[model samples]
Target: MTIYTVTSRSISARWSRYVGAHSYRFSATSNAAMGQPAFVIFNNRFVLGTVSSLLPATLYNVKVEVLDGDGNVLAEAQTQQLTAPDVPLNINAYSKTSSSITVNWSAIPKATGYVLKAKAGSSIIQTIVNDSSGTLTGLQPYTLYTISVQSSNAGGNSQPSPPVETRTVLAAPVIHSFSPNFKTIMVNLEPVSQAVKYSFIIIRSDAVGNKIKKTITSTNVTFTDLDPGTWYTIKAHALDANGIPGDDKIKEQVTIPCSPNDIKIQEIHSGNLTVSWSASPLSDYYTTFVKRDDGLEVMCNTSLRSCYFQSECGFIYFISVFSYNKVGQSPPGNVLNYTTAPCCPMQVKDLYVSSDTIEVKWNPARGAEMYETKAQDVSSAVFCNDTSTICTLSGLKCNTIYNITIYSYSDIRGFNYSCQKKSITTGPCSPSILTITKVNPSTINVLWQQNNRDAMYKVFAFGKAGVRSCNSSGNSCEIANLPCGATFSVSAVATTPGGKSLPSYSLPVETAPCCPNSFSVTQITQSMTNVSWTAAIGAQSYTTLLESYKGQAKCHTGETHCLLGCITCSTYYTVSLSAISETGLMSMCNYQGYSSSGCCPSAVKLYRLGSNALRVYWHATAGSVNYIVNVTSDNGNFTCSPMSGYTYCDISEIYCGDIYTVIVSPVSIDGSMVMFCPMKMYSVSCSMNSGAMVIYRGKRSLFHNKA
Candidate 1:
């Protein structure tokens, strides 16, 4: 075998020595920094050497001969065993999924295939590929892989490349949830990769190829300013550390519509309110807004064109409407103002009356802001207006009726009053008392006080005589020509337009009794007289009042015949007899009288007539028809009518040694005049047998002389 000595450069050249091909050619290149040359022959044998430019651990076949310049082989040698190539350079692993991994490296010279080994701690996997990049299947998700690559030939394997610690791509990000509104789309995903960022691609289904893209460092993203009532397709992916994207997922959602338009109020009533509006084409339901001027508001939802809500009486409110869907609420529609009617007022109550006044009270009516009270009479009318529910009316006529009415009104609703009529009357006062101011023997006068000026009075005089009356419009009245010693009862009354008041309490009056006109002495004697007079009418009794030289004297009697006994002769007497009525009325009658002239008896004496009798006598006067003798003392009086037709009379039944007054009166024939004898004091000292007491004393003296 021989080696070549000279070398030349050629782009296309013919071969001089050949081991297999007939037109084969060879060329060699060397590294300048290694300072090694090629194509040098030595030691008389042509040596075919391995240069450093050739691939490591590779086999080459060469042809050697002694030919001068012919393309022929005399001696030849070829290697059958191929060696492994050098280790792969710059190995990297990326783009991991839940079940697969992708590895890449710089290609090695003379390498037939590559052996890729992926290790996660104790777990390992191996694969072979004839290319610079390989993907390993059936790998764990979201796991760290210690990856290495080696070049291999038919002979053996090269040293393993520098071990590269890289994590398989985290599992593909899962789409958790998504939502689409009128202006925005929100997306949420579960992280399946160890990725620090995510990318969202939102594409409208209606607008093909129109997409909205955004990148965020979190697992959630939101795309805004999208069309309303539109459907969108969303795609989300988690990016790796090398800025490569994993498998992405898709989800679909739609947005809501805008607000409804042209809202209007249909009707407003005391209990309910109705509202209607134009329905929105993209809305699913409607919401009505009802609000009052007093800061009250309410909301209700329905799918119909009109909606009803309960309304408060006498309140003014603003109405509006809106449309909404599952996404969100919409803007409100045009607003309208509404008002309700006021309710009726309650009836009047607690009606009462006082002296010359009336009081009216009532309950408050619903939705009433003010009230008016009117009271009307036949002569006048009164009105009161205020916010209160009570009123008082004054200055009314006594015992008069008045009509009352109340009116209720409000600002929101006009005046509406439904009330019943009421009537009340004032009461009258009491009348005054009747009195008697003057009275006389035959006339009576009466007077009374008047409470009311238009009152009437009546006076009546009664008792003993009869009844008498007189009426007067004034406070005073006079009843004339009434009997004396008469009594009267009186009363008064007052009247008005309503009714007559009760009569006043009765009063009593009396007149004086009349005096007696005639008085006379009918019969008279020396010692006594019988008197008589004309009796006054209505006199209960008569008193005989006398004034004489002896003293004044008074006597009361009910009989017409009176006795004035024991009169002194030649003495003048002034006597008055007064009459008293049952009512204490009094009057008097006067008279004058003197005792009659008569001869009185002279001396009177007494003598013993017998054992049971006494003799009394006196000198009789010439005018006496017979001498009337009497024996009188503190014991009793005893008289003899004619003294036995003698000037003396004997008195019997007299006790001896007892004193007595003997009287003798001279009597007239008509029993009108009498004369009184001088009374004598006498005693019977001895009996008819006077010697009996002398013998009794002489016998005692004789017995004493003998003893």
Candidate 2:
């Protein structure tokens, strides 16, 4: 590669004799001359180099000549034209699954097509590329990958791109959690000539796709709780599926493997597997895992340094750890064990099984890159691992047990076989946690107990309610247009990378009845009433109750004279009063048709006739058959008596001078005064009819006193 340059200083270190002349040559720049070129020497003293990096691929003309002996051209050399460079390399990526990874790169600008390849060690992980992109299916978590692309044309070949790299896609992030200190992994892709976009995916080890994984356009991505000490490969490729290079292909780059301490299990319920460890001495390593014997893979990267592996009902699992970087995988760390046993489990101390997969973990053999694990179902047995323990074995019949063997390894490349450890068998998975959640008034969200290797969410609507199915990460669903207050039946199951979970169901759940709003009462007749309410939202017709009362005070008071499915203004109600809705939640007002109005003049009393004593009597405005009379004097003299019919009372104890008072009120069937009027007083009157006598209608008698 040549660079553009102007001669800076060309004082010859030592002069050499010109081939065919006695003259010698020297070089210098015009700027360095202080004011101008020290001497006029066209092609000899002022030598300039072409700027290759700055030169565009467009046409450029070049001329060359050789100066011999003196500052003069001795011979003309070659003239050349520069052409634009072929399109660089193109690259892109996608996922065959949550665990598998795919990547593609553009063919060389002048080449026929592209050839794709991936390397972990010297071992080619994947190779083949009639197409630009190729999938590396079923990769292990926390593994580093060296990805590359070379350009080819009929002319033979151009140089290969600086090694492009990518980590296999990491297992999805574990635990859908929100916290303040969550670690964010920032992936930096190499700078290319053009501004291009890319697609990325983040999956938790035990989860289905996030159901909402965000596609980041920026080169750097922030992921929380990555598997520590484990190498995670997040692929970056051009947005074009054809891997078409726009102008310059971006150099593929994988994330630096996180430290093992950063990878950990966040939580566990059945809590069969969760890996927690302190920071290791190594900086180039990152990854933590709870390997299931059930053929499920689990890994996490986070500072809290933990990973979760859920135990199914009959399955078992254990944990293993390793840290690594670009150069190579590190020795394996300590192994931890756990299990989910059913009935009588003999392998519990060393192993566990979930469905067909069985997992086993033991104390780490020092210096192991990982442990080699194997499983034998009722049928077939296979060994798969360069270096790793806690292997998952599959292909067993449902609910059946199988034997397992484990071995220790020093280096995956060096130690290819398993060492000795105890043997065990597999078991079945636990019943999925079928939870019903209300997402909205019209929708339900169903989910199951958490598992690292979970795959899909299945919902079953069955029985008298008929049957239906919906797939989602949310375990629950919204059943729309269901009759309010109607009973419904439902069941849910969870699918995992290892196997399927058991189904759980809800007891006859029922929808709530709608309660009416805007309740009101109207007088139908002098003696009748009507009540009404508005329709409740998202529910059956509003339930209404009516009550009749005699005053401005609302007749509601939780009383109802009539029960209404639907009431218009003219609904002639019997004044029935009752509570409404499932919970009887109601407004403050009662059905006024049946409830009484504020008592009118609770008690009425007549003024005094004389000063010595007073009498009290009253009458209710409504139905009443009897009354009562009580009398008290200002001097504290008091009396009481039962009275009927006529609403008046008179007491005798006439005195020449003294204030007296009287009260009159009505009584009810309960013998309590339905209406009461307050007492009034009058100074002793000389005449008992003083007030009435003043209103005498007849003309005063002017004639002589008749006998």
Candidate 3:
């Protein structure tokens, strides 16, 4: 007989067919064991049989026999020295990575070693191990694998166990770059092999339980709403369809620094400026940036909270602060706006001055937004404000010296620059209430209210002759040598060391005219008189007036001589003369003239006295001391004498019935006289016994009889 197949638990063998064989029997026995071997029986038609009760990897002897109807053996076959191990069971694959896998199986009986095979995409890898489990290596990442295990001994090898199918994990993701901001952080990763998604986590290093998680299909991820100036740990991993994770990539990052607070200006000087701010967390240093309106920029870096830089006056500066570290610079902190103090005003000049107002001008100051000027004196203080170079101050004391100061302002609060103190003197005040105190024929005295105690005064007189002026230390002054008969405008002015004032209110004054000389009156008549005088200086006309008891007369002329008419006869008269000037001022002559009557007498009368006595009467005459009367008749001539101081005269020794001539005459104190008579016939009746007579003169008859 010959052996065909052998197993760890059993053995089979075959032989040639026997002739006329009813059945077959097979038997196998181990050569090293002392126990009986196993056997098997078959039918007459069979030629093969397997032996039972065999040991694994043990030497065995197998025999087959053929028999006739019931008695003895016809033929027999025999085989020896055949052995095999049992098959492995329960095969599995676990712990899969990107390039490797671990496999395990149940151990077979009497097996000395194991053999593992891994297959993927028509390629197979074999490995021999003495243990039940082994790892498969040198495989592609993220690939499917089919794995199997087999038992082996020194005699022979058994069949493999059932196959197990699995796939390796995906490759780990690689970190590429990191981006950080004040409040956010972003992570970028390299692509992973066979990765369907990625998982990311960020944890704050300074805080407990502060973390963020995300899963995405892309390789980049960003975490937001984070604190500034903070440190964070980042992790990223690739994932498979089964949610299996690969190796992780880890990194550390930091956000930018936090913004600074409470920016301030510490100090400012002519050429330097200092700035400060509150500190920022996690910042190594601070930076201050300054920008000017004129396109100039500067910066200062410091580890402290404050910084200093060069500065200039009158410039607008924009300032900002930033926190910085080795990682990066943070966003700018609070922005500050500032301006330096301006320079003082220069080149001060006086523009105008009045009694109570003063105007001043100066050069423009750099960085100055407003200007203030102050004028101070012993008695008053005044101020002016302006945006430009010129300023006007009012309500100032006149004729006084004032100290001046100028201040300049800028954007810096409560700060101003000032210049050197200066001095200015105001003009003297104008005199008021001008008055002409005294006036003479050739001079005028003027007075005014004094505005300043220490000032000098000047009085001016303007007339037809010309302008005349007078100066005095007091308020009153006299203008001498003024022309007569002229009206003048007078004014007063005050002067000091500062300046002269305007003229005061004007007053009009007039001077009197001089009297005329050599005044006389001659050629006096009953109806007219003559008057003459020497011309007076500045005389325009002459006036003559005559006065009498009966009548009076007046005359006016431009010449020195004039006549007075309408004089009464035999009457006393008085006369006067006056000189008139062009301004209607008059001055009378000092002399006067008087005239007495120098005319003849008038009116005559005759009367008859008893018998031998007769009387005649006539009117009296001025300046005649005595009178004489003459009576004439055809029979005789007669003479008569009048009483003293009386205008009547008596005639005696008359003849009756005689033709007579009657006449009357006046004698002066100078003793020169004249008379005239007319002849007339008078009728007289005489009676010797009765003692009575009647007389006739002219057309009247007079008779007287003794009783």
Q: Per-residue lDDT of 451-526 in model 3, one digit per residue for the tens?
A: 7858888888887868999998887877888876667888878887666777888888766655675777664444
* lDDT per residue as tens, model 1, 580-626: 88766677666665434445666455556667576555565554355
Q: What is the Cα root-mean-square deviation between model 2 and the actual structure?
A: 37.3
Show model 2 residue runs off by greater than 4 Å.
Answer: 1-350, 355-357, 361-546, 549-622, 654-656, 668-676, 687-707
TM-score of 2: 0.26
**How do the predictions measure up, each by TM-score?**
0.36, 0.26, 0.39
- Pull out the clashing pairs in model 3: 1-77, 1-78, 22-44, 23-44, 314-367
* Full candidate order by lDDT, most accurate first: 3, 1, 2
TM-score of 3: 0.39
The positional error of residue 64 in candidate 2, measured at the CA in angstroms, is: 99
* Top candidate when judged by TM-score against the true structure: 3
Cα deviation at 687, candidate 2, in Å, is: 4.7
Better of 1 and 2 by lDDT: 1
Q: How far off is residue 557 in model 2, in Å? A: 10
